[model samples]
Target: MATAAKKESKPNAGFMKPVTPSKILAEVVGTEPMPRTEVTKKVWDYIKKHDLQDAANRRMINADAKLEAVFDGKKQVSMFEMTKLISNHLKA
Candidate 1:
């Protein structure tokens, strides 16, 4: 007899929960409540639209005027650090 395939697990509820963004972050992601995943997506969209990724280092992001505030005056941040910095601008 053939064995059944394992079922896929659902995403974490906490991750899907909505959170409001701070004023600075709102400039980039808009003034609306969204899950952390969506917030990250919107930020990425803005980054791509503005071509903020460093050409020399693809893993680094160069903050623009709006992003500068969100990044806490940071001129550049790594992709990994971007997530941590963005979290500081989010609130449940």
Candidate 2:
């Protein structure tokens, strides 16, 4: 009896495709078109750089003036909600 070879999983095409960020998002992530993964990374970088995460609750992200626009005027959002909010600012 022989063991079957493992199959590798490919990344989702949609996530890898380059997307343009809306003006509000561009202010945080820059104006260049980038993959969704990179956009998330950059957004997280900005959040970390600015110390925007809430001290009381690590999962909560406090929106600054620029981020408030991206977050649809929300003053604070959870880590999970952030991805959904950011999606609105990206276009294919």
Candidate 3:
């Protein structure tokens, strides 16, 4: 009897779709258009570089002057909420 061939999985296009960041978001992720995953990575990099994560609670993010604009004037936001807020600053 012949064995069945294995099927390869395709990458998710939605995650790879290019999105343009607003001016506020550009401050953290740069001005180039990139996939959402890359944007999230860049944001995390900036957060880490600036030591913006709350010392007491890692899940909380401390927004600086630059991030304040992106965060709609909020000084602090949760790690989970950060992604939701960031989405508002992105456009197709």
Candidate 4:
């Protein structure tokens, strides 16, 4: 019998900063230090609350003023792309 290779888990970068208000994002949606995952979730909540998701294509999020700053001034981005944008706010 052949042994299966061990799976390596992606390490958590570090303890995620607690979600709080941020400066650049202050006007966008109130800046804060949240785990990368939580930040996205919160952004999605804002999107859903404001109906920012595209009706024709749900993957794209229409950036609001707050999101625009976080997204590097991007007006729109896919769900996958959102991750990269959110990462910029995360601090060590």
* CA deviation > 4 Å runs, candidate 3: 1-9
Off by over 4 Å in 4: 1-22, 26-32
lDDT by residue for model 4 (19-64), tens: 5545665454555556655666767778899999989999998988
**TM-scores of the models, in the given order?**
0.92, 0.91, 0.89, 0.67
lDDT of 3 by residue, 1-92 (tens): 43457567776899799999999999999999999999999999999999999999999999999998988999999999999999999999
Predictions in order: lDDT? 0.95, 0.97, 0.94, 0.73
C-alpha displacement of 59 in model 3, angstroms? 0.4
- The TM-score of candidate 1 is 0.92
| Steric overlap count per candidate | 0, 0, 0, 7
lDDT of 1 by residue, 1-92 (tens): 43457667898999899999999999999988999999999999999999999999999999999999989999999999999999999999
Query: Who wins the TM-score comparison?
Result: 1
Query: C-alpha displacement of 57 in model 2, angstroms?
Result: 0.6
User: Which prediction has more favorable lDDT, 1 or 4?
Assistant: 1
In model 3, the clashing pairs are none
Error of 1 at 23 (Å): 0.5
- What order do you get sorting by TM-score, best first? 1, 2, 3, 4
